[model samples]
Target: MNRKNFLSSLLTIGAAGPVLAAAATPNAVPSVSRNTAASSAALPTPLIIPPYLRPGDVIGITCPAGDITAKEILPATQLIESWGFRIKVGETVGKKDGVFGGTDDERAADFQQMLNDPELSAILCARGGYGAVHIIDRLDFSPLANRPKWIIGFSDVTVLLCHLHTNGNWASIHSKMCNSFPDDWAKAEAIQVECILSIRRALSGERMEYKVPPNVRNRNGRAEAALIGGNLKTIESLAGTRSDIDTAGKILFVEDTGEYLYSIDRMFWHLQRTGKLDRLAGLVVGGFKVKPDDPGEEFGQTVTDIVTARVKGYGYPVCFDFPVGHQKDNYALKYGIPHLLDVQEGAVTLTDTSVPAAATPSL
Candidate 1:
């Protein structure tokens, strides 16, 4: 089906409304309404802060989406281990079940085990491909809802993050996985080194403030709200499902790679028509890498232009080319947490305001 038709079908399902209220149980992250605005009055006041990783804490690594070999993650595993943390490689890692790391059952089982393990302070995804969507809904997130730990990765892992955020009110990290880390920074590009630094900072519970380079397409303004969104394709895929995020009055960040320019425009239009863009407190556009135009046909608009057009009069701060996506400089973002986005004279700054000033010890 075409994008329009597919989006319409999803909207129809969403309009039918949620079939059941999220079960209220101990250690369950309370679910919020999909249509609720993100204003302080609309959202629940309680913010769930997962246990931050401390020295010697254990991090469990699992492949929830794509197939990956043990060799590919060795560098990242060793790096984290060197950071005074223990690493637990899941059973599914290096076990190929066709194009996936393992069967859907295996993938879900591995991730589920990690989620329920109190010894694990975080679960690091091995990599992202296409299979995450298949097992996302199958994972029982309730056990980890209140006793939260970081869920880390981007791309296809967006499905897991969105589901956990929307249905369980859990916070997750949008950052690099094992496959993206390099063993030798001396031979790696500067950006890859930055990626590793970002991961380390995130794991160490350091609240980050970004001075985003100016983008001509950016709308000059400021607002503070919870941050949401990830890979554009993954966000689009969650539409009409239980995982669909409620962006009302929230700062939504999006990025994608290897897609036609026209497809990105269509996805933005989908967001607009579905009212996702209308209620945003801000919009952040990250790296759109290797976007191509058709051989004989051109979209005649850059990703920047398309985004600017879609969010034209909304007036919320819109920062483009903010590094986060299928790129080496992909910085980590904490989703489902309040952040301040300020766009002023020739600069953009994003500050995480979710954590209390006196809360956690810094690295």
Candidate 2:
């Protein structure tokens, strides 16, 4: 079907209601009802971690969101290949249908193909713009249930990450995509180089840990639980959908770019009202590049003020200015995997506590 017709069909189904719309999709995974206020006890099944990549393992690159020319991903391919992994460029990489990488069907098919390809150890998103939600429900994740592979990217890809976590209990990488790759590696800033290299370390099965200077507003405490979250706006948008996250017993991290303080405050309020902030292992407030309020219309509160006001009653650790989000220092985070969040007056640290695949409990 053409894009226009497809969208119109969606609108018709949506008008009927979300349940009917989801039920109409043959391959759609049923949304699991969760207890948002569940205790912080360990889950019965540990998150499934896809096999770590090795020398010559194939990493597929597909454009599930926005358009990106083959020439643009050259730097990313060259760099990833340097890490001893082969690159399999998907058909949607250079294709364009309006601002999207391709038609929704095309992008979904490309990603589904990668997910089912046994040779592809990981699928790296070429970029994240505004189309991942358009194709998410259309793709079948049954293949991933049997042969899970690392799904990498952030921004719009947060929809995919959250869907994987909420529905399949699969672990994924939340990090920079192809668009963030530096064209000239030699001239890249120190932070850029470090962030890019962190992706390699994650896919190679290295235990991940990071430390950042503490903000005066940080609440000192420690908690260990599965870490989950991404762009705040994206998280808020997924509410009431199949991809909506369950934060009952997890360390949640949120970040965003180019939003007004009031908008940010509203999103936080949504979280609180929806019981997302009622119980948590901790909260990591990542880099938020708030847009300046218009003249004569300033929002009286800062990001920290807005956050602390909401979670003041919760005893879990709350740290600000975390090094994750749309910034040069944005580090890779393992979604669905258990992590240790330590907040102290002097510093904050997040550590991956994933066990060997053989030792991990299976679903």
Best-performing candidate as measured by lDDT:
2
RMSD of each: 8.0, 8.2
**Where does the lowest 10-residue lDDT sum fall in candidate 2?**
6-15
Clashes of 1: 0
Candidate 2 stretches greater than 4 Å from native? 1-44, 355-363
Per-residue lDDT tens digits of candidate 1, residues 254-300?
99989998899899999999889987888899999756676888878
> For model 2, how does the per-residue alpha-carbon lDDT over 152-253 read when each residue is reduced to its tens digit?
999999999998777656689999999999999889999999999999988987788888898999999887778899999999999999889988778899
Give, for candidate 1, the lowest lDDT window spanning 10 residues. 4-13
The true-versus-predicted C-alpha distance at residue 107 of model 2, in Å, is: 0.6
Candidate 1, TM-score vs. the true structure? 0.87
Instruction: Supply the global lDDT for candidate 2.
Output: 0.82
Clashing pairs in 1: none
